[model samples]
Target: MPPLLAPASRSPWASLPEDLVRLVSWRLLAGDLTDYVRLRAVCTNWRSATMSPCGRGVIDPRFHPRRWMMFAEGHGLYPGHERLCEHTRFLNLDSGFFVRVRLPLFKDHCVLDSVEGLLLLQRDEDTAIRLHHPFTGDIVELPPLASHNLHMSHPYANLPQLRPISASVSIDAGVVRVMVIFIHLMYAAVATSQDTKWTYLMHWRLPSHYGPLSFRGEQYLVHETMNIENTYLSQIFQLEAHSQDPPKLIVTFPREKLCYPVYLVECDTEILVVGHNDISLTHLAVYKLADVVLDRFIPVKSIGDKAIFVGGRNLCVSSKALPTIVGDTIVYRHPREQHFMQYCLNTSSWSLATDECSTM
Candidate 1:
């Protein structure tokens, strides 16, 4: 009777049907992960209706791969002796937008690879390798690199400079593999999730300059082979994990002139070999693997509304999914430069991302 004087008015947003809210959330999630996070943070009702980005962890296939790159801001007294700030800054590849997020994971870890929204981290002066989900604080531990046998084999081994070349994780299968190069020892080591120690693989004649490239659901490692004629050819080998058998030679490309280093990348379910110059990649050529059995590659003219990111891990994404990002272009950062540079495949020209500035 007391409340009969007036009826409480309900907010329209809060009263929205769950089905409708979920539909909108799906659309936002399909477009961008940031939009989905913003939608969930609006209200409790909205949050309840929408699924979490980290609900299934970073390994979930439903979550979108990160299109943004993390950058560290320089601080301290001078340029040579500057210290990096703890705060994390991410740059969106599509819109070139910058966002600041607090991530405590970077405090003591070094990023080895960024794959499928997960980071491979190694702590300073620590031999343990771990997989970290930056947002959800989920951690997966892998086998350490240091062991008694390693020290016995290499008396002058420096464990601190363990440079991880590539890392891959499969949460469902409980599998994780890391490939690291030992500079001082001049060999490559493979650490499997199942093994407690590392396996050493030494190729005295042909040294691998880059990591493994996955194509057609199989892992393949590409290495440059020099012929007596002084021409470089890319040799593809089938990689077998946890096996004593050596890698089998699959196919070899035709002898051709080489640039800085050839890289293998997977794009749109196809494998591509990218060749570029060392100096800011002034010249670049892309070729698609037309026939694996024949060891043939067709010159690729356009990637078709898709953009490729070349770095530690090569990735291809549809620009149509991100309207602001230009299609048919390659985005990369020079080791000597602090900003990103874009190379238009269609126009055959290069342009600097003036607005997008960050340290790689």
Candidate 2:
């Protein structure tokens, strides 16, 4: 009998059908954009079989770095000319990639904060606030700053310099909720789609620094205040859903050890207060709120295997999530020098991040 013909040889990956290749590409959804881009560039057939990962609608939850800081470079010369300039770069700490993101909305507006993949922007001309999604080019116009009852007649009200101290957004089931605090306003305002006017929530005292934070499916505001005795206090106010009443103050604690320029960040379901001593450069103190009502600020020497990045806003991540990121460290940009620095919790040491993209 004639020898059986050897089966035709086949390359493992090359032999994968178009549908299988597409399925493999979808797996890259959990990876950084760089990896996704590279996967498509592998070959013409593979590229044709898969679509770009960035599409309309919510991003896949599996994406490694859910948030990114889109840093704004200076505006270009001429009217609307800056739109073409690739000045916006997205800093993805997870991938350590400074990918350029082009969005005309960023051209004339100043980015106030970035949360949940949305940007809080203030127009340079009128200081009007809006919510914008840089990647998807979606914009939601918020009530103009003039529409609010800011009590502009107050002596300390600086209308010209008036801007949001901090802002946050929560989107659920096609509904959007936005909260903003003005620098000179004694109250915070909330805006929802159902309401035409901003609902103001009054506070007992004006917060020196404040930001909106959400926990356990409820909206809350984190306030930092200082008394006449120079004692610093951190408080939490619970905002009621579908209620016009003012937010209730639920938690209060003293942060006497922390100095001025302190900021609040929610990480892993816990609130953290980060403080720095202007005179000291070697270390910064990080306090975790152990008990919202009963306990004082608990000193934390380290946040095991996690690194917190604080800039226009604060972001926390596990070092294992991004091998390039150092653990037990706080990364922040120096306000004066405009350079990025890292503070080691274990050693209580400070050093400049040598990575070129760290500055952005």
Candidate 3:
């Protein structure tokens, strides 16, 4: 005969072996850094067993927010909507899933640009700049643009004087390098984690440049200029990181079309040129490298199961991860439109993305 005894309470998640937890955490980190973060938040034991994204720092490639884009949710907020608005909504371009995260950085900073899920945030108080990863809550500070000696001035001193046209960040072996292109500055600014002040690269000849697009650890920019023949010309320039030397020109070609706003996106193994045929944002022409030596691009009708999310930094994602997203399509938001839109390369048609992918 034995007395009845209550069963000991235990959490299966907490009891998971440390070695198994580490393996699972690393596997999740490779695919989705957000998921790996959630796994750690499950229990104290699990958190201790997993490698913290913050511990490794934002420079670590494992902490990169891959295939994630912050959603633009501009809507009137009421009392009931407070909770919904408290968290920032990030959409997974590959899986079509929404991840809600509370970021304090957004409260006091305005996002100047975003690349590979890293936000170039400027503080509202003094326009101080910082690189932030929303998922990992990691931050790297940079000196304010005004702190640098620039003689340009205008009568409207009260207004926002300077703004970053575009920015690119490259991280290698825990070393971080940032390149910023300004709207009115003749020189581009380059800085590293080791530098206290920005290094001005005064060798750029073109006044209008689209991007310092990072492809395979190298930075590239589409330098557009008007020729004396009354035609537009675009040249590709490779920006050398951690160097004060001038950007190296990769190729030069005349633009047959007046494609005003162009984007150079890094796809899996190739670099893509995406542009709007007109200001209406209705038509898009996608191009890929045809000749490596010549740097010639050819129009492409399809990109297989890959999808491109267009923005300041265009992202290319595989649709196979989530069949919900239509493959071979470009997802973009028009400057005049309130919601997002999609252009299907296969059909050469346009559709409203709000119906398929709703923002927060």
Best by lDDT: 3
lDDT of 3 at 302: 94
* Sort by TM-score, top down from the best: 3, 1, 2
lDDT of 2 by residue, 1-360 (tens): 977755443335554689988777777755544566688887776788877545432223232234455544455433234454734666665545566666676567776655555677778777676766565455667766665655344443455445645555555565667766555555566776445566666534444344455433345566767678877665667654444456677766555455545556666658776767443444578877545345565568888877887655577776765566789989887565468888898998888865676345
lDDT of 3 by residue, 1-360 (tens): 766644433446677889999999999887887789889998888999978888454688678885688876656532124556557888876677887788756666777777667888888787677888877688888877555545333332522545655676777777788777665554567777677677666545434576557654456777777789876666677765555567777766546532656778877658877776665666888776435226555677898888888775577877865665678898888666756888899999988866743575
Give per-model TM-scores: 0.65, 0.61, 0.71
lDDT of 2 at 137: 56
- Which of the two, 2 or 3, has more lDDT? 3
Global Cα lDDT for candidate 1? 0.61
lDDT of 1 at 193: 54
Candidate 2: the clashing residue pairs are none
Q: After superposition, how far is residue 100 of candidate 3 from its true place, in Å?
A: 2.1
Residue runs of model 2 more than 4 Å from their true location after superposition: 1-66, 72-87, 122-129, 149-159, 202-206, 210-247, 254-262, 266-270, 276-287, 290-301, 304-306, 309-326, 331-342, 349-360
Q: Once superposed on the true structure, which residue ranges of model 3 sit more than 4 Å away at CA?
A: 1-27, 38-49, 76-86, 150-161, 172-175, 184-186, 203-207, 211-218, 225-233, 253-262, 275-285, 289-301, 309-325, 331-344, 347-360
Better of 2 and 3 by TM-score: 3
Q: For candidate 1, give the lDDT of residue 204.
A: 35
